[model samples]
Target chain A: MNSFTPDRTSFEARLHKIGDERYHDKHPFHHLLHSGGCTPDQVRAWVINRYYYQSRIPMKDAAFLSRVTDPALRRSWRRRIEDHDGTEDGTGGIHRWLRLAEGVGLDPDYVSSARGVLPATRFAVDAYVRFVRDEPMLPAVASSLTELFAPKIHKDRIAGLLEHYEFANSDTISYFQHRLSEAPKDVAFGLEWVLDHAVTKADQDAAANALIFKTEVLWAQLDALYSAYVSPARIPPGAWQPGEGLLQ
Target chain B: MNSFTPDRTSFEARLHKIGDERYHDKHPFHHLLHSGGCTPDQVRAWVINRYYYQSRIPMKDAAFLSRVTDPALRRSWRRRIEDHDGTEDGTGGIHRWLRLAEGVGLDPDYVSSARGVLPATRFAVDAYVRFVRDEPMLPAVASSLTELFAPKIHKDRIAGLLEHYEFANSDTISYFQHRLSEAPKDVAFGLEWVLDHAVTKADQDAAANALIFKTEVLWAQLDALYSAYVSPARIPPGAWQPGEGLLQ
Candidate 1:
């Protein structure tokens, strides 16, 4: 290897370092949500905006799958779509997220409809879908490496929510429960694929940058939530106002 | 007409009302920018991020035109691409924007490369491109109606920049100056098209929402800029840092 190209172990460390420094787990909003510091309105805003992200997961996976040419890759990737969308409509990660929304007192239908998602959340999530759709396979696959960071967040969220919120339950927190299992399996494959493919220095750089971009995607969503509904609390025009999309 | 469907005059009034209420003109970032309250770093940040918006204009127009089956519409839309892209490189509104970048002591090439744009700016602008590329023709066309409110902002920008910033000059301010004439012509056609086509109340509502969506897109970018570089000033990872892209 050239002086510039790090060995595989080092490259792996770099990706993990990015997560350690930059993952949405580090975002203040997550700290608030996990610790139960969020008010009911704040929690509701989180559910509403987060549903936009959840709703797009399958779509993002589908966009990724649409671009994969290899049968093995397609078969493996197809599981992601199925996981979010489920074999039937009432199942899957998205439905679990809706259950959480309902548990938090939102109308599941309204949350599913995504009528009140913050524009920043939509923009951030849509950028992700497009990134997966349009970027080359390496970076696209590398972007999913953020999943490497997901399991810890899921654990924190489940434990924190259960301890603090009356709304938390096996049903309401099941989405994160499921992700605690699902993400590691998915990340194992994605990390292997990225690590195996990113042999050259330039390849490693692209992969690293893609992972950084994904973290921003995650971080920006929380930033939007925090900016709009937290500290300064300047909710932009057309976003969900408090009490607007509650269960009727 | 049914009671639900607004008359053309009122529909136009409704669009103007959305602009008055939600357009980026009212964004504090703009107020800071136009009134010369921004520091040199803020100006540079705006220049870098706004260039991403400018760079995408032609590609957005091309995406719009690729979907246009009608020859007259294609013919009309072609001007937008031409206006920004020019017949050759380094000649059009984009080039003029680069002049502004240089005037602000930034590297024109760096601005053109779009390496330093904020993630929020990219997400918001890319969402606009995708909206135009994918939405039904009405909302897609309606989204561009933000241009209807453009001339006044352009005029304010020109007058404000010239009066306040040392970097402001004829060459640097020409982009806004050019848009002074160009935007009116574009908006006249777009407004007429939306008014003529939105016959049903649902259609009017869709167009109005699309216009509102466009305003949000514009406002979100500034919100991002403000959030990152203004109030909380928490510059998201991978966005332009203040001193990195300066001209030598």
Candidate 2:
């Protein structure tokens, strides 16, 4: 009996539904952000902590590639690494991240080292990597399907950061600029990979689970940040002190 | 004795020498950049490809932590991660990175995924990670000693990009604005680490080598961008398409 079936919707719709439900819009931080309820210290803390996960996605993709057994899948998936780490000579997403690090008043070297990242952010991003690593290959690839709905979030995020945050700037966020094009391509590839491989009811269930897991991965990071930076005490260790038109 | 030993200049001077002889300043693109010789396409490629590397630095740092066994060292080193990641979750350095992406008029997700980033960029960044992981721990820390010299280069790069690259706005590059303060703190910490840890002649030599290695890692990425995007080709296979007024 096929207990769990792939509810065939436009891949976009399914992914969008995930965002609609779990994308942090309902979180207090979003409310505070859009409503301008956050403190400047909160904003600075937000900027400093998120950089860890920002820096990890590409390398984690590379680690994921190392675990995959299929050559065709490997060939296709390895590009994520190149997208982040760059080629034989350098010049890629990591470098762009350094520029972002600088924008938030971080030293690129310190930022890049991930030495001081929030425990929760590290755990969430680590969970993302571990999810991709431990899951079925189909689901592993499926996890990245988040990109299917990314352009919309990307748009909202850019406008929200620029309009609401004081320390924020569009140029400092250039890492996202290129993602508009890259996400479509990556989603298309990931979608096709999942569709081709996830033919069983079980696979479909796993695929949905992968998406949920990824959502949690992102959600948890945000939750940690909100707890640490957004509210009552701002007690997270190593948080950035705000001043001079910072994230307020 | 292996004779790549550097002379006894002030630590700052030694660091500056690394920048002078091996920094991207010597790269052809910088010359073309400062001389007003690059086409719009060349500038666009530079912006887009570099975005990949800019986004990934902190990940390498995290991975470095994953490998190291010391708790106190990790505790101290962890501060770097917080500086870059910030406390607001994605609103931190990663979010700021997204802003930079938006400034370039690229999609944040696409940029974050680094799908269209250049191959050369990947190579250089990987080299940094590899250098950290492959070398002795002190040199690995020393490799990051490059931060000491960054304030000057960052200032120069900002001035040059603003002056020579018409596509950029000061706001677009706000990531650097924050770095002016952050880099010095980090450099002080790193320099202190190296001076204290480089307890032997070989250790000092490795520190020097680390600085050289870091400088080359950055310079090579620029070189690759120059060759692929500037003048002759306009756009290379999988390189970014040049757009007007999108200087990064």
Candidate 3:
């Protein structure tokens, strides 16, 4: 095992490599979804399933916040919960996701209930939360580095969805639009924190692996979606069946 | 909202009801597996998937221990990690779980590596760890109340496997056997602690729900298994496929 830790730029490159190679944006389902390839049913399925991930983000952040002792860290992390959960009225990333659900012709209530989400989706998202909660401080912080790769995906998604699907609009896609601004700040802070703390080679390797793990958490969710909804569909029992929860 | 906390007997009954209503032992997959209805491949799948949960027990306990400030609580909780991780090599629940993996004709290394386990299993098990690590002390402690229900399942599992599967032996089944003795002490303490601390109605409800959430974690894993391995199988992409990871 290499015992030498790379300098900051090299370390940052290694982190980017993980995202470039492993981030879920590269998943085939995203390719299909973004490029006008998915049917309305498939889009609905994605919206319903992806909602599970969106809803859990704040909870995951809250779990992280609960463990943090540093007042400044807690204060910084607290904004994440607010961003997703909203300040007063229901108006955050989660609410925006629900709007996307509605725009996709799904019932907002049904989407929010999350009862119809794929079991695999639930598992993958929950795994992300657990990783944040239980891993050592460095790796836990590193896992959030997936945000480093998020802005581009959000940009691509906003562009591709608007260009491809009729449901794509400023109001409906506001979640991604908002995230474009929100994610970079989070990622910048997170990436710096990880780089600063991961002084040892072992710690660096762990942080890299944690980023990879986060990517898997994301990639796995898409894999589940593709397997169940794409060709030769084998939607797992009790997962949202296409045409089941469409908006009236 | 009910402002009155139920008396201890009522609270205890409520906890049992959550188990009775939601435990994985009641899941159809368990009925099949316990009754020898599963094929060998199905059994192998169970072993590989369930191992993820078994291996994480110590890590979960350690996360709990790290958060714990009380020496007495830490002293009591530390035993759980030891029980699973062992004080020395060639011991602990994780090692025994691998032995069972071996008993069922799987490569212990593959099992330990956990590369082939279902993503769903990883998620559910990780969620349990996160719940323990991050939730408020009362609810976090209450989640372990599922242990109160574990002994019976262990009893059932041991008898059923012995009666049904040729792999079943005194040695292979010893993990569950050991848990039978170990869990009761843990649960008795956990249940009492929960009862003692859950003084408010809201606390009692959160505690009850935490236990219920845990039962879902256990139940969801079996659901993923049954969905993937049972009828009209839709194994999430990259989960263990039977005949792939077995001992040669």
Per-residue lDDT over A22-57 for candidate 2, one digit per residue giving the tens place of the 0 to 100 score = 765566776676555676556555656666766667
Candidate 1 DockQ vs. native:
0.01
Error of 1 at A145 (Å): 0.8
Give a tens-digit lDDT track for model 1, residues B91-196: 6788899899999999987887788788999999989888877899889889999998898999999989999999999999999999998988888888889998
DockQ for every model, please. 0.01, 0.02, 0.01
The interface root-mean-square deviation of each model, in the order shown, is: 16.8, 14.0, 15.6
Docking class of 2: incorrect
Q: How many residue pairs clash per model?
A: 0, 86, 0
- Measure candidate 2: CA RMSD: 16.6
Tell me what TM-score chain B of candidate 2 gets against the true chain B: 0.82
Residue lDDT tens for model 3, A1-248: 25476887899999999888899889988999889999999999999989888777766775676456333465566567657766444577888888899999999888878888899998898888888877898988999988988988988899999999999999999999999989998988998899889888888889999998999899999899998999667988898887887789
Q: Write the per-residue lDDT of candidate 3 for residues B61-92, one digit (tens) a residue.
A: 65665455333465566567557766456777
Over the full model, what C-alpha lDDT does candidate 2 score relative to the true structure?
Answer: 0.65
lDDT of 2 by residue, B8-101 (tens): 4454466566767776666777777656677655655665666666555555555555444433354455445545555444434555655666
Q: Which ten residues in a row have the lowest lDDT in candidate 3 chain A?
A: A66-75
